[model samples]
Target chain A: MTAVSATPTATPQPRNAVIRSARDSLVVAKRNLIRMMRIPEVVIFGLVQPIMFVVLFSYVFGGSMKVGGTTDPGVYREFLMAGIFAQTVTFATAGAGAGIADDMHKGLVDRFRSLPMARGAVLTGRTLADLVQTTLTVIVLAIVALIVGWRVHEGIPKALGGFALLLLLGYAFSWIGALIGLTVRTPEAATSGGLIWLFPLTFISNAFVDSSQMTPWLRHLADWNPFSATVQACRQLFGNPGVSQSPAWPMQHPVWASLIWSIVIIVVFRTLAVRKYRHATS
Target chain B: MTGAIYAEGLVKTFGDVRALDGVDLDVPEGTVLGLLGPNGAGKTTAVRVLTTLLRPDSGKAVVAGVDVLRHPNEVRRLIGLSGQFAAVDEYLTGRENLQMVGQLYQMSGRDAKVRAGELLDQFNLADAADRPAKTYSGGMRRRLDLAAALVVRPPVMFMDEPTTGLDPRNRLGLWDVIQDLVAGGTTLLLTTQYLEEADRLAHDICVIDHGKVIARGTSDQLKARTGGERVEVVVHERERLTEATEVLRGFGKGETKVEDHMRQITVPVTGGAKLLAEVIRELDSRGIEIDDIGLRRPTLDDVFISLTGHVAELKEDAV
Candidate 1:
């Protein structure tokens, strides 16, 4: 070991602290990613549910559900892909919450707190790692979607934009999960809390059945939903049906709505989650 | 700095319960100060406040010369804390856990790796370095957690009940490691419920109860406060206990306490060896056959009983 001062003389400058915070977040993210790798089950199980959703929803409801007034299995499958992709990314919330609650339960967060690292790095790192995991799950789900006759007719860049939007939504929701994870005492509670509300959130959106078939009030609620906006934007970018929708601003201007919704969620939830973290630990 | 770790009039409350009530502490550099207390004695709460993990409602602490509330980050840089719970990541390998801690302390990648390896070896965790800490026994996990705290080798360290659940052998091993750290110039403030642990390791011991410092001194000094040495004699026959008590009272300084079931009589005294000899001779002359007789110095247990009006609660060991 090298001889270093008990208290390092060079206190990190304000500018340096920002850079250090980013670096520390990456370090923590790396640890989380490594854990997912070593366990294998975390990623395996994460992929399993979305794949099940892809296969089950495609085969089971392909012919029955109507998309753009067509009951054709082929057309409906493409429409279903957008919903599955959105669902997969958002479903990652439960896993993110469970991960954090587990860490707190085991006192790992306490260990991190005792160190001289940036305060927000731990939560940011966790969400970042969950983002990476969601990315991988999305890629694998995209491949499964393609196999099941879902195509991106809009070409590569737009397709990439669609995937990027889905990821943004996922990353945004992961912050909500982070907040729940911080609040809940047990991982089990976090898991249930993360998932229970998400069911109605995704179901009532433009993701699954075209919200147009629903009654007036249900249609209105779904059209205005932020989740519905992201789903609608992905459908447009993917060059799939259901792009033409009601006059709700979020529905009509889906791309801007998706970006604005995700950005707003990130800003609001990240602040709340970080505040929750400091309070819970303190 | 006058003391490596110093605090004055520290007070913290959770709802209605005051966890720390006007607690003051001063641990000189390169020495060990043991905060000895029973369960919920606010020892852990004090450590949390001093380590900047929790804010105190009133008073101040300067750890390694950094004001805890004003410059918590500075205090963090100069101190390492191993909390009451062993705070290691169960998913990470022992080596990985240490490496992560090293990186958090801002050590370079290569430096972190090197330090992690050194710590694994130093803590006798090299054999299990590659294993996930979830598979580690309680003692091994504790060693890993302790190693994590030492990753940056800060000048001062706070260990809250560092050896609480370990078996005796592992406890001894940890004590050795702590002593070595102190020898290498690390000032330490360790909280423990074990009197024997404080007696063996602490340069000074502060006994606390109900969130306040009840007594403060070296082991011998605190023992002396309860009174001087005691003369204890156990008669072979229960009927002869009265004779033994009479003989003990002749030379004893305090009231003679007789236990009929054990046929034992104990009395406090000032003169140590001469008092013991006189008791033995008198008991023998009075036909009080003895099972055992000895002069006993007061232990931390007795001091605790004297100060708190009760025993230290968790008497896992006889001491």
Candidate 2:
């Protein structure tokens, strides 16, 4: 072993702080992803809920829901898959928040803060991990949707675009989760706080029901909701049956709306979350 | 030589309570400065400031010659910190935890892997290297945490109550590791409520109370400040306490104190074991029945009591 002299001299560390920060974030992300792989139960449990939603909503309410001027159960099932995919990605926010909150509660964030790495890397890395998890969940949910007779009439490129939008939306929401995780004191509180608002946000949107069937004010609210925009965009991209006439500009241009909404969310929440992280660990 | 850790006039307040009030510290390179304080005495707060984890309201700190507030990132590269709580990731294996930290410190992948294996072996965690830290005992977790701190072998280290929750055997083991680190010339500032721990580890002990340094010296120096060796005798009968006090005063160097209720008399003395033997022979001839008698040096406990008028408020967190 080489004897290390404890001289208080500045060792020549890698000077590119920016590059080091990016590398550090990737390292943290890798750690989180490895943990998920080791604990297959997390992935399994994450898969179970989306699978249940696909099966239950397909069989229970499939026949009664009207879409594209018809009550055809098959058409509704096809329409519902897009909403389920969007909801699944959004709901991953809870796990992201809980994971981050648990890290904070355990003093892991303190450890990261004391290190000479980028300050925002810990959070960005965590959100990146959630993005990977969301991507995997979306893949498994798509197969379940296929098993339930849901098919995309759009070209393969458009179908890929829809999945891309779902992942992007999930990534954006995970930042909000990161913010809540930093704000809350416990993992349990973060889980509740992360998922509580999500209920109304997803339920009141055009994901589960037709915004055209609701009252004028309700339709307007649902049409403009960011959640609805993603759902509508996915529906159009997948060539599903739910795209009906609506005066809401977002609904008419769901693809552009979904991109803009996700970009805006990523910008706002990432800034706030990183700021909160600095204050919290400092 | 430039001090490895130096801080001046650090002041921090949480609302009305000043956790650290004008605290100054200087720990020259290649030495250990034990920050001895009771609960809530600002030892941890001072450490936080020096480690760049907290920004003091008004202070100047230069750690490893980097201005803490101005170049905290540069300072961070030169120091390692093991906090009061073992901050190892419970979900990651011991080796994985160290490797992750090594990578964060910008060591290359192969170096991180090799270093992790080396640390795990050195910390006696080789057997559990592949097991998640959550499955390890408290001592094992602490060892892993300390190992993480040493991954880069930085010039300075700040360990806040590092052995607070360790068994005696584990604490001794950790002490040996620390001794090895210091022998390699690392400067350390360690904080602890256990005076014994401070005595065993610190080159210089700074005793703080109520957010201020009340005394600072070498262990022996501080002990001497409390007083020299003393003779303590508990008489077999309460009525003989006064007579015992007079007998003890003759042998002792200073005023003798008698506690009538406990039948005990105590006094400072210069002589070591020879004086103790003479006192025993004299008392035996005087026919004073002795229940217990011994020569006692001033321990850090005694020093703390004399200086602060209260025992160090030790919590039973140490296992």
Candidate 3:
């Protein structure tokens, strides 16, 4: 084997540590994608679920609910389309978190700690891999949404912009999921916690129904939800006609609210996740 | 770069249990250090500290010239670790696993692939390179894991019970692989329950029990420390087992016992090979014809049982 270093001894690697760290993390993410690709069934499941959700909610549920006194109306699809997009992306975040828990259980992440890689790479790589996955899922779900009469009212650039927003929104959720995976000892708990957050946050928000038409308390909660901020952002970006005109702080521009919420959630949850990781390993 | 690795007064408390009790280690370059310990013996805790996986709250450690506590990332770059478990992802093909590791060390795509293929062939996983690692047998998984650790060729390597589940044939095969690595100028710190492994692989062995190194010396030195010649007498009849045991009892004053499972009588004799011949002659005179009579030095097992009151515990706590 040819040694890369020409010197008699290898020395300390002090300069460009972060660049090397990020490069290493990119390798980790690519490996994850390869692993995910190996289980074609899992990839198929991840792809199919969002489309099924779009059909179930937009067609089946859309016919039953009346908005503006018109049952069997098409406006509900437009109203809930962006919200559904957000929900689909949210569902994909569990992959990042569950992957971490599996790696931990298998002792892979612990092995990385003994190597010259960045401490955050394990979590960061999972998040980055999920960003790509969530993007792919978004593109596929978008096609399915189009099949179900869900059209983007915005121009091509704005629609592209909307796609990027949904992905960032997914990445934020992925960070939370990564923490969940790192903190939770078992895969079962990691999965259940993801579900516990998903069902309520997705359902209780305006993703399924109009928040204004719900009970005063439920409406207030949904109005303030992070998912709602995301959905509101999606509505503006997609140029959807039924976009709510809520002027809640950081909500007027759904884009900024979603971005801020994603950043805040990433910071708070990652700090907790890193702490849990340090605790469990030591 | 002075001592290859230094761990001083390493202390770790897991809630109420003190896993490591102020353990201290100093290892020089270009040598293999065998850490022999029973289950929960804190050998792993020390490895975790020196490898920068876990922080030692009260102690300072340096690995390959870098302080592990203050500069973990630098220490990380200089060390390679193959853990107790084969931690490679099952879904990845063996080749992909190696490639991923190479890339993790910042090797370019072409360089990483070349290194990955070389390791695949070196570890004899080339034929199975494209197959997912889940399909590899236990021995193959272990070999691939070791190969992955060598992707960047770090100066220091830590193997924690690397051959616990491997069969005898595969275990020997892995021993050869480790020997080659160490012979090629890699400094290794390996922990194992197999006394034969330490005897074969480690130049100097550290016998640790209850979170402390009770003894550290060369294989011969350790065996001589627990000085005694061991006799294994294989006889024809099962009842003769007891007869050989009784006769051998007369030869050694320390301890004499029947190894019913292997059909041999074992006794600790201060007398060397000359006494072995005398014992055989006495058994023959007493009409106890033997199939085989073998005399050997005490193993690390004996030194451990003498010092710690326990056998090696590599299997019990394996991940």
In DockQ terms, which candidate is top?
2
Ranking by lDDT: 2, 1, 3
Please write out the lDDT profile of model 1 over residues B1-319, one tens digit for every residue.
4588899999988878888999999988888999999988889889988888888999989888778899887777778889777898888899998888888888887888999999999999999999999899998999899998988788889999999889999999899999998888888999999999999999999998888999899999998898888888888988777766767787878888988888888898988798778777777777778889899998899999999999898543211
Candidate 2 runs further than 4 Å off: A1-15, B314-319
Q: What is the C-alpha RMSD of each candidate to the true structure, in Å?
A: 3.1, 2.7, 3.7
For candidate 1, the TM-score of chain A alone versus the native chain A is 0.94
Fill in the DockQ of model 3.
Answer: 0.44
- What is the C-alpha lDDT profile of model 2 across B161-213, one tens digit per residue? 99997999999988999999999899899999889999999999999876788
Task: Itemize residue pairs with steric clashes in candidate 2.
Answer: none
TM-score of each: 0.95, 0.95, 0.89
Q: Write the per-residue lDDT of candidate 3 for residues B76-143, one digit (tens) a residue.
A: 77778898889888999998888777766656778879989998989999999999999999999999
> What local distance difference test score does each model get?
0.87, 0.87, 0.79
Residue B57 lDDT (model 2)? 91
Q: Please provide, for model 2 over A53-151, each residue's C-alpha lDDT reduced to its tens digit, 9 standing for 90 to 100.
A: 888987899889988888888988998998899989988788778888988888788788888888889998999999999999999889888888989
**Candidate with best lDDT:** 2
Which ten-residue region of model 3 chain A has the weakest summed lDDT?
A: A1-10
Tens-place lDDT digits, model 1, residues A1-282: 111254442232334878899999999999999888888987998899989988888889989998888899888889988888998999778988998898888877877777788889998999899999999999999998888898998999999999999999999999999988989958999999999999999999888898988899989989988899889998989998767569889988998999999999999999998877765652
- Ten contiguous residues with the weakest lDDT in model 2 chain A: A1-10
Q: Considering the true interface contacts (CA pairs under 8 Å between chains A and B), give the fraction that model 2 also has.
A: 0.48
